[model samples]
Target chain A: MIEIKSLVKCFGPTRAVDGLTASFSNGIIGLVGQNGAGKSTLLRLIAGVYHPDEGEVLVDGIPANDAAAKAKVFFLSDDPYTPKGADVEGTLDFYLGLFDIDVDNYHRIIKAFGLPTKRAVATFSKGMKRQVFIALALAMKAEHLLLDEAFDGLDPLIIDAIKSEIISAAEHGKTVVISSHNIFALQRLVDRFVIVSKGHVAREGNNEDIGTEFVKFQAVFSSPINEENIASLGFRVISFRKVGSVHHVVLLGNNESIEAVQKAFNPVFIEHVPLDPQEIVALEMMLAKKDQKGGEEDA
Target chain B: MLKHYISWQIRKWWPMLLIFSIILTVTALYTNAFTTMAVRYYDNGSEYVPYYSFGSTTSNMPSLFIVGLVLSLVMSLFVFSYRTRRQSVDVFYQAAYAPTTIKRVRLLIGLAILLLSMLIAFLLGTTVFLLRYVSTPAEEIKNNIKFVRISVHWGMYFLSFFLTFIFVGLHYLINCFLVSLGDYTFDQICLLIFGNIFLALCFTSPVIYFDAALMKHGVLNDYMWYPALYSLGPVGPVALVTTTMEQAIFQRDVAGDFAVNAVVSSSIYALGGIGALAFNLFVPDPSGEHADQAGARNQAVAMIPHGAAAVLGMLMAALGLINDVSVLALSILPIFGFILFSVVYYALLALWRHSFRMKKFDLICYVSVVGGTLVMLTFAMAL
Candidate 1:
C-alpha cells in the first residue's frame, strides 16, 4: 500500500503536484490526465525520485524516501535509464546488483519478449526499450510498482502482453499505479481511475462509479436553449453544444438532473447517451477547465 | 553491497585507470632517466673520468606530482558525473542503499584508484633506479665524482612519498567537492578550474598586497615573502614540493627547515581536504530534479568564486595604490576589474539558468555581491 497525503511539489514558480492526496493498495489504478497535468510529477514524488516540497508519502507504513521503503517499490520512468554501452545482460546485472529480483522470471520475460540478451538496449526500438524496463520492474517483485507512461510507444500485441503481465502482478497482491494518456488501454487494464487536473485529483472512483457520474445526453428542443438555461435548471453542465437545434450536453449530477433536463427542455425527443471511460475522462477534464476559468474570473 | 558497487565501478572505469597508470609509469621512467643522464658528467681529473652525482631520489619523481594531479582531477570529475544527469541520477540514487553510502563508496573507490595508479608508477620508478644505481660501484663513483652529494637519504624518500600522497589526496578530495557543487559536466569542469584558481588567488593575493604595502614603506626584503607564500591554498603544496626538491638538488640540508615547512603546509592542506570531505558528504543530494540545471543546485556555493573575486579585486586595487601608480589609473583599475568579473558572473548565471533574462533573485544576488564588495573595499582603504 502506498499512501500520499497532501503532497505538494514545485519547480520554481510552477507547482507541479499541488496538494494531491491518493492511495493505492493491491490493484491497478490508472492515473489519467492531459499533458503537463502533473501525473509524471506525482509518480516521481511517490518513487522518491524527487523529494516533496511539502507533505509526505508512505509505502507500507514507511516513508517513501527511506531505503527500506524504496526497496519495496520499483519506479519505471517514461524514459528509463540504461547506461551507455550496456547490453541487456549488463543492464540486468546492474539492476540485479542493486535490488533483489527473481532471476528466473527476468530471463523468462526476456525470452518471451524476444529481447536479445546480447544486444545493447540503446540499439533497441522504442517499444523494445520499454519492454526491457517493464520486464525489470516486473522481475523486481516489489510490493509497489510505479510506471510512468507505461504504454506510450507499444504496439497492440506487446501492449496486450504487458497488460496481462500487469494484471497477473496485481493479482499477486502488488499495488500497481500507472500514469498514461491511453485512456482506452487503461480502461481495459485498470480497476480504478483517478482523473487529475491542475495538479489535483478532480475525480477518483471505481470504473462503474466514474462512468455513471458524468451522464451524457442528446436532446432536441423546440426553442434554442443556451448553456446558462441548462445550469439554471440544476443540471451541472460539464459541456454543452448545439448542432442544428439538437442539444448535446454532458452533466455531472444525479438522476434528478437528468429528469430536470428533460422537464425544462420539454424536448421533442430526448435520449440518454452512455459515456465510455474516455468520454467520462474528457467530460471531467472539460468541467475542470470550466471551474479553473470561473475561479480565475472570480479572483 | 559496497563491495559489489566497487566492483561495478572498477569494471566501468578500469580502462581510464589503466591508461593513466601507463602514462604515469612512462613519464616516471623518462624523468628518472633524464635526471640520471643530466647528473652523470665527465670530470677533468687527469684523464676524463665519468662521474655520477645522485643528489635526491625525491626530485626524480616529478612525474608523480604532475601525473598524479591530472589523474586526481580526471577521476574526480568522472567519478561524480552520476550527479550531473537526470538519467544517471535516477539509476544510481534510486539504488536500495542510502545516498550517504553511495557517496562514501564512490569516494573510497576513487581514492583507491588514485593511490593504486600512483603506487604502480612509484614502485616501478624506484625499481629501475635501484637496478641502474644501487648495484653500481658506489666507492668508485664517489672517488671519481666531484659533486657526489646524496643529501636525501632513504628516510627522506619515505617522507617525500608520504607527503606526495597527501598532496594528491587533498587535490582529489577538493576536486570532488567542487564537482559536487555543479549540475552539469561543463559547469563542473568550470567550477573545478575556476574554484581552484580563485582559491589560490584568495590565499596569495593578500600576501602580495601586503608585500606591496611593505614595499611602499621601504621595509620589504626578498626573503620576507617566503613565510607569506607558505599557505597558498591548493597551490601551497605544489610550492612546498618544488622548494623541497630545489633544496635537495642544491645539496642544501633540507631535513631541518624544509621538512618542517613541508609538514606544516601538508597539515594545512589536510585540514582543507577534511573540510571538503565534510561538505561533499553532508550537503543534500539535489537528486534528479536539479540535474543538468547548472547553478540551480547550490546557489550559495556557486556564488563563492564571485564573492572571493570581488574581495580580491579590492586588494589588487589597494596594491596598485601602494605601488605609487597614478591616481587616475588606480581608480580605473578596480572599475575595469569589477566589470570583467561581473561579465563572467553574469555569463555563468546565464549558463545556469539557460536564459539571459535575469530573474529577480539573480539581480538581488548580484546586488548583494556588489554591496559586499564595496563594504570590503571600504574596510581595506580605511586600514
Candidate 2:
C-alpha cells in the first residue's frame, strides 16, 4: 500500500502537486488527468524521485524516501532511462545489480513481446521501448508499480497483452498505479480510478461508486433555462449543453438530486443517461476547472 | 551492493580509463626518453664525465600535468553526469541503495581509475629510464668513468607518486563539486571552466597586485617577489614538483624540506577536498524536475566565484592604470574601471542567469560586488 498525505511539490512558481492526498492498496488503480495536470509529478513524488516540499508519502508503513520503502516500489517513467550503447542484456544487467529481478520472467516477457535481446533499447521504436520497460517492471516483482503513460504508443494487441499482465500482477497482490491519458485503455484494466486536476485528487472511487456519484440527464424544459437557472435549482451542474431547446446536463449529485432537478425543470420529456468511464473523467475535469475559475473569481 | 555498483561503473567507464592510460603512458615515455637523450658528457682532463640535469625533463612535460588535470576533470564530469538528466536521475535516485553510497562508490571508482592509469605510466616511465641506464655501454667512457652520473632517486620517485595522486584527487573532488552546482550539463561545463579560471585568477591576481604595491612602496624588489609569487595556490604545487625533481637529480639532502612543503600543500588542498566532499554529500540533490532548468537553483552560490573574480579583475585594472597613467588620469580611473566592470559583469550575469532581464536578487548581488570592488580600490589608493 502507498499512502500520500497532503503532498505538495513545486517547481519555481508553479505548484505541480498541491496538497494531493490518496491511498493505493493491492489493486490496479488508474490515474487519469489532462496534460500538465500533475500526473507525472505525482508519480515522481511517490517514486521518491522528487522530494516533496510539504507532507509525506508512506509506502507499506515506511516513508517513501527511505531506501527500504523505495526498494519495494518500481517507478517506470514515461521516457524510461536507457543508457547509451546499452543493449537489452546490458540494460538488464544494470537493473539486476540494483534489484533482484526474476530472470526467467524477464526473458520470457522479452521473448513474448518479440523484442531483440541484442539490440540497444534506444534503437527500438517507442512502443518497443515501452514494452521493454514494462517487462522489466513486471520482472522486478516490486510490491508497488508506478507506471506513467504506460500505454501511450502501444498497439491494440500489445495493449491487451500488457493489460492482462497487469491484471495478473494485481491478482498476485501487487499494487499497480498506472497514469495514462487513455481512459479507454484504463476502463477495462483498472479496478479503481483516480481523477486528478490541479495537482489534487478531484475524484476517486471504483467504477460503481463513480457511476452513482455522477448522473447525466437529458431534458426538454417548458422554457429555455440557462446554466445559472439550473445551478440556482441547487444541483451541482458539472456540464450543461443545449441543442434545439433540448438540455443535456451532467450533475455531481445522487439520485435524490437528480429527481429534484427533474422536478424543477418540469421537462416535457426526460431520460437518464449513463456515463462511460471517459465521460465520467471528462465531467470531473470540467467540474475541477469550474471550481478553479470560481475560486479565482472569489479571490 | 556497492561492489556490484563499482563493477558496473568500471565496466561502463573502462574505455575512458584505457584512453587516458595510453595518453599518460606515451607522454611519460617521451618525457623520460627526451631527458635521457639530452644527457651531455664533458671531457674533464682524463675522463669523460656525464653532466646530468632533470629540471629540463619536468619543464618539458607540461603535457603531463595537463593530461592529469584533464583526465581528472573529464572523468569527474562523466561520472557525475547522471545527476543532470531526468531519466538517469530517476533510475539512480530511485534505486534501493542510499544515494550517498552510490556517490561514494562512484568517487572511489573514479579516483581508482585515475590513480591506476597514473601508476601504470609512472612505472613504465621508471622502467624505461632504468633500462636505458643499464643498457648504456661502459666501454664508451674512457678511464672507466660513468656514462650517466645520475642514479634513480627512489625517494623522489615515491614523493612524485604521492604528489601526483594528491593533485589528481583534489582536482577530481573540486571538479565534482563544480559539476554538481548546475542543473544542466552545459551549465556544469561552463562552471567547471569558469570556476577554475576564476579560482586561478583569484589566487594569482592578488599576488601580482600585492607584489606591485610592495614594489611601489619600496618594501620589495622584483627579485624578492619570485619566491612569494610562485609559492601559493595552484602554482605552488607545480613549483614544488619542479623543485623536488631538481633536488632529486642533484642528489641533494633536502628531502626533509621537500617533505614538509609537500605535506603543507597537500594538507591545504586536502581541506578544500573535505569541504567539497561535505558539500556534495550533504547538500540536497538537484531535483529531476529541475533538470535542464539552468540557473534554477544555486544561482547565488554559483555566482560567488565569478563575483569575486570580477572584483579582483577591477582591482587589477586599477593597479594597471596607476602604473601607466598620471595622478590626474588615476583620479578618474575608478569610474572607467567601474563602467568596464559593469559591462562585463552584466554580460556574465546574463550568461549565468540565461536571460538579459535580471531579477532583483541578481541586481542586489551585482551592486554588492561592484560596490565592494569600489571600496577596495579606494582602500588601495589610500594606502
Candidate 3:
C-alpha cells in the first residue's frame, strides 16, 4: 500500500502540486491527467528521487523518501538508462550483479525478454531495451512498480507481454501506478485512480462512480441560448470537441442534466451517451476547473 | 559469470584490442628496423658496430609507446561514446548473481585485463627474440641473442596492467557515478572529459616513463623515481624484449645480454602486477546509482565562506609559484577559478544540506563542524 498526503511543490511563482492527497493498495492506480499535470513529479517524489517541499509520501505507513522506502518501489522512467559499451550479457550481468538477483532469476529473465543471450546491448533494438528493463525489474521483486508511459515505443506484442507481467506482479500483492494520457486505454487496466486537475486530488473513487456523477449531455439548439439559461440547467461545460456542426461538450453534473439538455434544444439528435467511465476523466477535470490557478503556463 | 564478463569485454573490444596489439607490435618492429636500417645502410662505420647505442643509449620504446597509447585512447573514446547508451558492464557479487560489490567487480576485471596484456606481451616478445636469434650469422651472435630476447617481464606487465586497468576501469566506472549524479550540466560533462584526460595522463605517464627506462637495462626495476613508477613497473618486462634485441641478434657474444634482459623483464612483470592492483582501487562504479549518492544530497548546508576559501586558495597558488614569477603571473585565472569553484560548491552543499529537517544534535554538530573549518581556514589565510 502506498499513501501520499499533503504533497505540495512550487516552482518560482507557480504551485505545481498543491495540497494533494491520495492512496492506493494492492491494485493498479491509473494517475490520469493532462500533459503538465505534475504526475511525473508526484511519482518521483514517491520514488525518493525528489523530496516533497512539505508533507510526506509513505509506503505502508513508512516515510517514502527514505532509502529503505525507495527500495520497495521501482520507478521506471520513460527515459531509460543505457550502460556504456556493454554487450547484452555484460549489461544484464552488470545489473544482475548490482541488484543481487539470483543466477537462476537472471537466466530466466534473459530468455523471457527475448534479448539475445550473448549479444551486446548496443546491438539491441529500443523495444528490446524496454524488455530488458521489464526483465530486470521483474527479477528484482520490487513490491511497487511505477511506470511513466511504459506503453509508448512498444509493439503490440511486447505491450501484451509487458501488460501480462504487470498483472502478474499485481496479483502477487504488488501495487502498480501507471501514468498516461489515454484514459480510455487505461480504463481496461486500472482498477481506480486519483483524478488530478489543477494540481490537487480533485476526485478519487471508483470508475463507475466517476462516470455516474459526471455526465456530458449534448443538444443542438434552435437558436443561441444565453449563459444564464445554460447555467440554469445546473450543469457545467468545461470544454468541447467540435466536429463540423456538432460540439461534443464535456460536463460535470448528475444525469438530470440530459433531460435539461433535451428540453432546451428540442433537436433531432438526442442520443444518450452510454455512460463511458473513460469520459469521467474529462468531467473530473471540468469539476476541478473551479479551483484552477487560471494562468496559462507550460512546464 | 566473471569469466563471461571478460569474454564480453574482450569480444566487444576485440577491434580495439587488435588495434592496440598491432600498434604495439608495429612500434617494436619499427625500432628493430630502425636499428637494422642504420646498421645496414648508414655510411658511418659506427653504425656497423653490433653494440652501438642510439642517441641516448636507450631504445626509443617510450616514444613509440606514446603514439600507441594515443591510439588506444582514441579507440577507447570511440568505444565509450558509440555504446555509451547501450549495455552496462557491472561487477557481479560473490554468489554469481548480479554484481555485488561494484568496486570488487571492476578490480576483478582490471586484473583480468592485466593478466591478458602480460600474457600477450610475453608471447610476442619471446617469439621475436627467438626469431632474431635464429637469423643471426655467428654462433656467438646466436648465443648473445639471449640478451635481446626479453619479453615483457611478468612483474612489469603486472604494474602496467594495474595502473592502466584503473584508468581503463575508471573509463567505465565513472559513467555510473556521473549517471547516478543525474543532474549534470554541459559544463560538468566537459569537466568530466577534462578529468579523464588528466587521469589518463597521470596513470599512463608512469608506464611511459618506465618504458623509457626499460629500454636501457631490459629490466623494470632499473628505473626508480620516474613519474608513474607504478605504470613503468607493469610494462617494464616487455622493454627487456626490446632492449636486448641488438646484442642478442647482432652481437657475436650474446649470452650475457640475454641473462640481463631476463632479469629486467621479470622485475617489470612483478612490479606491474602489484601496481595494477593498487590502481584498480580508485575505479568508480556507476551501476549503483540509487544508493550511491543517497546521502550526497540532503546535506548541503554546513560549509565555509567563499571569501575565505579564495584567500587560502591564493596562498597555495603563491607557494606553487616557486622561483618563477612569470609562471605565477600566468597562473592567476586558473588558480582563481579553482578557488571560486570550491567556495561556491561548499556553500551550495551547505544550503542543500540545510533543507532537510535535522535532528537537534546532528544539526548542532554539523553547524559547528562547518563553522569551525571555515573559520580556521580563513584565520590561517589572514595571518
Candidate 4:
C-alpha cells in the first residue's frame, strides 16, 4: 500500500506534481494523462527517486524515501538505463545482485519474453530493451512496481506478454502503478485509474466508473441549435462539434443528462457512444482548460 | 557482490588501464637503455652514473608517477560521469542500494583503479633502476656511477605514492562537488579548465621570485624559509617530491632544508584534501531541479565572497613579492588575510540575503574594522 499526502514536487518554477493526495492498495492502477501531466513525476515521487517539496509519500506507513520503504519498491523508468557495453545477461545479473529476485521466476520471464541473453542491450531495439527491463522488474519480486511509459514502443504480442506478467504480479498481491499515454493498453490491464492534468489529479476512481460516467453522444436535429442552447444543458461538455445539422458532443454527467439532452433537442436520432480511458482523459483536460478560460474571462 | 561490482567497473576501465601500463613499460625500457648508453660514454673508471641526473641526481620516476596519477584521475571523470549520465541516475539511485552507498562504491572503484596504475608504474620504474645499476659489475659501478642516496631515493618513492593518492582523492572530491552545480558536462569542463589555470598559477614560481630576492640580499634564512613558502601552492607537492629525492638520492646537504619544506607542503595538501571533503559534504547532492534553482539563485551570495577573498589574497601576496619584503612571513600573512576576508565577506552576504539592516554606528564599525586592518598593515610595512 502507498499513501501520498499532499505531495508536491517542483522542478525549478514549474510544479511537476502539486499537492497530490491519494492512496493505492494492492492492484494494477493505471495513471493516464497527456504530456507533462505529472503522472511520471507522481510515480517518481512514490518510487522515492525525487523527494517531494511538500508533504510526503508513504509506503506501508513508512516514508517513501526511507531505505526500508525503497527496498519494497522497484521503479523502471521509461528510458531504462543500461551501461554502454552491457549485455542482456549482464544487465540482469547487475540488478539481480542488488535485489533477491526469484531465480525460477526470473528464468521463466526470460524464456517467456524471448529476449537474447548474450547480445548487448544497446544493440537491441527499443521495444526489446523495454521488454528486458520488464523482465528484470518482474524478476525482482518487489512488493510495489512503478513503471513509467511501460507500453511505449512495444508490439501487440510483446505488450500482451508483458501485460499478462504484470497481471500475474498483481494477482500475487503486489501493488503495480503504471504511468503511460497508451490508454487502450492500460484499459485492458488496470482496474483503477488516476487521471492527472496540469500537476493535479483531474479525476480518480474505478476505471470502469470513469469510462461509464463520461459518455460520447452524437445527435442530428432537423433545425440547427445555437451554441447557448447546448451550453444550457446541465452537463459538462468536453468536446462540442457540429457538421451540418448533426452535433457530436462528449459530456460528463449521470444518465439524467443524457436523457435531458434527448428531451431538450428532440433530435431526429441520438446515439450514445461508449467511452474509453483515453476519451475520459481527453474530456477531463478539456474541462480543465474550459475552467481556466472561464476564470481568465471573469478576471 | 562488492568485488563483482568492482571487477565489472575495472573491466569498464580497461582501456585507460592499458594505456597507462603501456606508457609505464615503454618509459621504463627507455630509461634503462638510456642509462646503459650513458654508462658506456662516461667510462671514466667504472663509476655507475645515471644518464638522466646531472650534479643534482634524481630519476624521472617521480615526474612519471605524477603524470600517471593525473591521467588516471582524469580518466575517472569519464567513468564517474557515466554513473549520472541520462537515465542512469534513475536506474542507480532507485536501486536497492542507497544513493550514498552507490557514490561510495564508485569512489572505491575509482581509487582502487588509480592505486593499481600507480603500483604498476612504481614496479616498472623500480625494475629499470635495479636492472640498470644494481645488476651491473661492482667495479664498473664504483668507477663511474655513484650510488643513489637512500634517503632521497626512498623519500621520492614514498612522496610519489603519497602525493598521488592525496591528489587523486582531492580531484575526486572536487569533481563530485562541481558536478552538482549544473549540466554535468558543462560543469566538468569548466572545473577542468579552472583547475588547470589554478594549478598553472600555483606553479608559476612565486617561490623563485622570493628565493632570488632573498638570495640577492644575502639573507641567511634563504635556504629553508623561502623554499617552504614556495611549497605552499600546487608546486609545493612537486617540489616536496623532487627535493626529497634530491636530498636522499643525490646526497645534497642543501636539500635537507628543502626536504623540511616538502614535509610542510605535504601537510598543506592533506589539509586541502580535508577542506575539499568538508565542502563536498556541505554541498547537497544534485538530485532534483530544486538544487539547480537554489544553486543558480544563490550563486552571487555563495560564490562572490570566496572569489573576492581569493583575488584580494593574491593582490596582497603580489604586493609582498614586489616590495621584496620577507616572502616567508608575507606568504603566511596572505593565507590568514584570505580567511579573514572570506569570513567578513560571507557574513555581509548573509546579512544581505536576509535583508538585515545595520545601524549607522554598526556600519561605521564594520568599515573601520576593514579599513583599519589595511591601514595597520601599510603602517607595519612602512616601519
Candidate 4 displacement at residue A88 in angstroms: 1.8
DockQ of 3: 0.07
lDDT at residue A8 of model 2 (Cα atoms)? 95
Evaluated on CA atoms against the true complex, candidate 1 attains a DockQ of 0.59
Give all candidates' CA lDDT scores: 0.75, 0.75, 0.51, 0.64
Segments in model 2 whose C-alpha atoms lie over 4 Å from true places: A254-262, A295-299, B40-63, B138-149, B223-233, B244-266, B281-284, B311-315, B318-348, B364-383
Give every prediction's interface RMSD: 1.7, 1.4, 9.0, 2.5
True contacts kept of 2: 0.70
Q: Encode model 1's per-residue lDDT on A1-299: one tens digit a residue.
A: 88889999999899989899988877999998888999988887777778999999999989888888888888888888886888888888878766778888888887888888888999999999899888889888678888999999788898988888889889988889999887877867898988888888877888777757677788998888888999887667878888887888888876677788888778898888878778887777777778878988999
Assign candidate 2 its CAPRI class: medium
C-alpha lDDT of candidate 4 relative to the true structure: 0.64
TM of each candidate vs. truth:
0.88, 0.88, 0.51, 0.76
**Alpha-carbon RMSD of each model:** 4.6, 4.6, 13.0, 8.5
Tell me the tens digit of each residue's lDDT in model 4 across A41-83.
8887877777788999999999987767888899888987786
The Cα error of candidate 4 at residue A210, in Å, is 1.4
CAPRI docking class of candidate 1: medium
Q: How far is candidate 2 from the true structure (C-alpha RMSD, Å)?
A: 4.6
The Cα error of candidate 3 at residue A41, in Å, is 5.1
